[model samples]
Target: MRSLEVCKCSKTQAWYLFLVLVVITTLSFTGRVVYLSLGEGYGISLDPSCKPRRHVVFLKTHKTASSTILNILYRYGEARNLTFALPFFDHLGYPQLFKARYVKDFERNPSKEYNIICNHMRFNLPEVRKVMPNQSVYFTILRNPDQVAESSFSYYHDVTPAFREAKSLDRFASRPSTYYSPSAADNHYARNLMWFDLGGDHNAQGDPSYVNSTLQALERAFDLVLLAEYFDESLVLLREALCWPIEDMAYFRLNARLRLSVAPLAPAASSKLRQWNSLDWSLYSRFNRSFWERVARYGAVRMERDVSQLREIRRRLGATCLRGDAPAGAAETVPAEIRPPSFGTAKILGYVLRQDLTGPTRELCTRMVLPESRYLSLLQRKQALIKLPHNMENRL
Candidate 1:
């Protein structure tokens, strides 16, 4: 009873339908367009695509897993042959203040815009904006002050005058005010170091009224405030936010000490550290909640899948790039070029590549584990070569 003949579409009709399907598919992926601007400066386009946002200003906060982040940015930029606005004098020192004059040879160079700025500096929005583009996405990481206090005390013990007289960390923790003085030049490092690094008032830690404004200012200034505790998860969100390839974001934790070398924070000490650095604590706690909310927007299941894939990629890269296994705190496994520094009593482990590695693999492995100071030096030399032709570009 049914009709036997099948009706077929003409070539023109089929092609037109095909074209419409193609466009719909493309829009489905690159469809979502969101412009994020908090009532000023520039708006960033948030959408799905293969292309990544190139311009960024990453505030390298003290002992906040910042070294790892710096390496990631440097490696990515170098691959793209991008420029960095590096500071020559351990960051423009106006006794812990940032000014446009801090950018070395500021008056000489023709183009002020840079691709990335991840140097250690006291953040000043007006001054920082002069170096980066209006569309640049700004971000920074904050760690629990409890851990920061320990690391700062250990790393700067030999350098900071506050830690000079104290025989032990417990002593320094027991009576911080005895050693810490806001007026003392390097005393800034011993107290509210994170607050100081972000250009917040070091003295005003507990006063909610004052500290809240600082927190709100950061909320306005930065696109994201990452929590160091959730580093891998944060990286996943960062990769999505920037539309960067997941491969570009693969990382190995650097500048971490041997577990035995790290002093465990006695709960009492942690509480006191929190109270003493109340402003930083306030910032960290609030940002942490916000960090989670941001991740939730990115979808938790997809985030876990990406993180799993990332961990596996790292595992394979480790096998290819490193010796039998990653250093694992064993000194002999590390190479001299990438060896951990003898910073005080901490046994900071490093990595060594395979002897047989060569070509791009070797270079990639070398940079993956390179020390921060050494990498900066290498970048400076390369940048010098880049500048030699222009003559005027030699300012940095």
Candidate 2:
């Protein structure tokens, strides 16, 4: 009788412990679900006091070290717990889509305004006002047209299949007019120089109408303009204008790779490049003069001096460390071993879903999803996953 009683007590204790474990597991899952549903959107503070109250828009151009600046802004946003009107797609091309009321609708519940909005958006004044109604600051960088053309040509030639068949740079440089004449899908000059920065179509010839439009926009919308050639100086002015932290002004090196070199261009080839880019040179010179005039009128010198003082402060704070051999605005390279794989359909879908979701639910869903093959393929190719078509999905 005593033996039987002891066995019964042991069985009851085991059942109680099992019940407790099951309850704990269920509670853990429920807590996660609740956090996902309510917590993520409120996690970041987009209040005006965190940085400055005004809207800041950066016109990101190719090969102008714009990416480096964007990275800094992104970091600043993160530190301040602010949110960017990050594009649904990989790049921001259409300004018409981001109107003031549209942005308000996009940011429906937050009740707060955006501190900064920067992306690869086309230059549109009325559209910009729709999003940033008050005293918003607008800025962009300009590079020497000749250098811009050369860099753009080389970049496309190395990366795109259309340029791969060209025998030499001379062949590519021979036809400067065709480089940006709508036929070239990789029309960097047309896109970066004409539409986005200058607010005009490249097909039109020598109309200062675009220039006038840009100037008017500056008068009405922008407080500052930056030159890519003088990037350090540009950042200094930016720092002073925004009264940003000194560390924020420091340049970051990002997105660069060492390449094997071909022989130096012959004198004939060099001259060809110059001859081909005559239109670019002319436009650059014309715009540059106007840009300087605007700067003078705005008392940019005083801004520069203020920036210099801020740099000194940053130097004292030990945040002024310079990168070795890295070009301005390049990102640090990840080691091959730890780097994520390429993008594929599933990855693209996952990215889109994450962007679509709001609050804690989005965060939870993002964490729960498995690493899809599409993502791995995209990482390997270094291209936007969504750009690939459904027909080619299997190729990834």
Candidate 3:
């Protein structure tokens, strides 16, 4: 009977130990989930990495906060050390038709694989397809035509011959045809730039058939179309579409022209601007609704939660990556690395990185503020070094 009691006691102790182990394991798992929630996205799908989508084709449209999105892509791809279908020029033949020939070091039956293709290219889907993988996710951003035109007019005043003598957006909006000419050089900037950039006829006049066909084509070809106005919500949906982690989506505003230099678009001016850029207006109006519907599919309530979390993360990152006590509106306030090149007569905003950081933290902070031009240059240099003979790398 003593032996029987001793054996029963041993069994009871073993059961208690197993129960304790189960409790500890459960707590540890719950703790990890909690920790991730605090730093990453709230209300995001539990398993972001279950099946991550890496290959992407982001059409970088101009004056639509596309630069900021590019920065996000650049950081994510760079972090993973993923290969890029880098263009021979600054971009993959931007403002010109994208071709496989535009991709640097690309040849017939090239063996190297690319994971990301985010650059300014006058998108030609077939030509673009030859560069990236078959499974690459396609996406782009669009902005309100009035706002985009206002920005483009301000930035491209000199480059766009149409805006040269117009002097101001209001003046151009007052009598647009007086200044705008189809025959003018860089006339695309003065017209339906987004449509032109997407390989559509920017000059198409009141053809709903053409517009509908183009929209359908875009719908079929691209996985997502982000709106610059609803940028945060778009980003949340993008996170869902790409199955990207919250950290990969964080970004700082890039290429902001100082507000002091820009005037508010009057209601009438806005209307006139939209009327003048009818094709872009139509595209924006159609897609804005569709984009919202896409957000709803992703769950607007959850999207709101994620957006709030994303903002919080951006705020925290801003504090970490940028120097404080700098004037918000001054051109000289931030360093060149963060600042985009000034356009025409606009005072474009930039940022200064934190001075006290070093090592990986330092690199992260610096890159957060790096300009698109410098980032491209840096990326290209890295790529060049990568292609060099291992024995000859020291000479580089």
* Highest TM-score model number: 3
> Across residues 98-195, which tens digit of lDDT does each residue of candidate 2 receive?
34433323444334455666766666667665555366667776676545544444555544333444535556556544433445554544233433
lDDT of 1 by residue, 216-329 (tens): 999999998888888888888887766776666667778887777778778776777777788877888889899999988978897787777667667766776787675656
Judging by lDDT against the true structure, name the best candidate: 3
Residue 16 of model 3 has an lDDT of: 51
In the predicted model 3, the residue pairs found to clash are none
RMSD to the hidden true structure, all candidates: 14.7, 15.2, 13.3
Candidate 2: regions farther than 4 A off: 1-53, 94-112, 158-167, 177-184, 188-197, 208-220, 256-283, 290-396
Structural similarity to truth (TM-score) of each candidate: 0.83, 0.57, 0.85
lDDT at 18, model 2: 62
Of candidates 2 and 1, the better by TM-score: 1
Compare candidates 1 and 3 on TM-score and give the better one.
Answer: 3
Q: Which segments of model 1 are wrong by more than 4 Å?
A: 1-50, 89-95, 328-334, 388-396
Rank candidates, TM-score, best first.
3, 1, 2
| Residue 366 displacement in candidate 2 (angstroms) | 22
lDDT for 294 (candidate 3): 86
lDDT of each: 0.73, 0.46, 0.77
Which 10 consecutive positions of candidate 1 have the poorest summed lDDT? 30-39
